[model samples]
Target: MGRWAVATERRRGEALIRAIHEAVLAEVVDAGLGQLTMEGIARRAATAKTVLYRRWATPFELLIDALGEAYPVEVPTPAADNLRTDLIAALTLLTDWMVTPAATAVMAITSERGRYPELAEALWDKVFDPRGGTFTTTVLRWYAARGRLDPARLTPITTQIGEALVFKLAIDNARTPSAEEVAAIVDEALLPALGL
Candidate 1:
């Protein structure tokens, strides 16, 4: 293949990876984790088991890459001048997406990764670590700009604001968080952490 054709082919292969992930995520809703397997994934994705095995040595490794693709959890560089508002918007977006079908794959991948070090490394490096690192940077920048930046304060700041929203859905099983709730979280919880 030509260089461009080779690149296109690789992109197609990556699409197959995504398809397998979606298939598995659907199983989580329909049947849950017990149903996950390469054979099941290939059957659902309408591809072949040999194709999946050629691309991945094991299912956990496959799931790790799926997490990266599922999470578009990039650092928000919003133009809102008020740092608090910007932070709230960014964090809200992050939590909102976590309730999606894509997130089912993320949870499955994370659950699997705990038992497999190499799989954990792949997911952390490609998915969790990068997004967390970027979010940390975004929040710190916002705080510093507001003259409220303190290294000791960052954890409390995010947890009180962003993490509560996450836990509400994770623990409380709420369907979706609202804009008003996000605003309240930032105002009542996050601002207090910054001592504002």
Candidate 2:
């Protein structure tokens, strides 16, 4: 193909790949990850099964891709004020994020992938790291700017808060992380992380 023709075809191919990803996400969201299959995804995406198999080797692989598509890091940055307030807002955002249907399912999937370190690593590298890292980076930044941040204080606070929120949601089956609880995390963990 000519240069222009090649570029056009490449773009079209990229669009098709994205469409297939979307179709898989829709299927998983509608029917859960177990319902996802190569043939099923091919039929839903109006593509060939072989094509999907080439892109992904297993249902889990495909599920991870779908999860990545659905749970991309789109959380907004919190407005600044002081460490406590900014972090509280950040933790609040994290709270809402955990309960999102996509995030919740992804967490469950990650938990299940405990045996497959490679898959778990991929999930963390692509999805979990970005989300968690953003918050960590944000907290650090907040402290750096204020010149009052302390890691000793901030670490425990954020850790406790995050652990509590996650444990409560996963084990306790809570719907939302309370504002008061988020504040506690910021006050406790986030403070020491800076300098306290």
Quick one: best TM-score, which candidate?
Answer: 1
Worst 10 residues of 1 by lDDT: 72-81
Off by over 4 Å in 2: 1-19, 26-35, 45-58, 72-81, 130-137, 145-148, 152-160, 169-173, 184-196
Output the TM-score of candidate 2: 0.61
lDDT of 2 by residue, 1-196 (tens): 5988876553247777777777776566666655667777778878778888887898668767766766534323344445566566666666666665556556656666755567667777876566555444456545555655544454445544544554465456445657776666656654554445
Q: Write the per-residue lDDT of candidate 1 for residues 102-138, one digit (tens) a residue.
A: 6666566557665555755776687777665433346
TM-score of model number 1? 0.71
TM-score, every prediction: 0.71, 0.61
Tell me the whole-model lDDT of each prediction, alpha carbons only.
0.64, 0.61
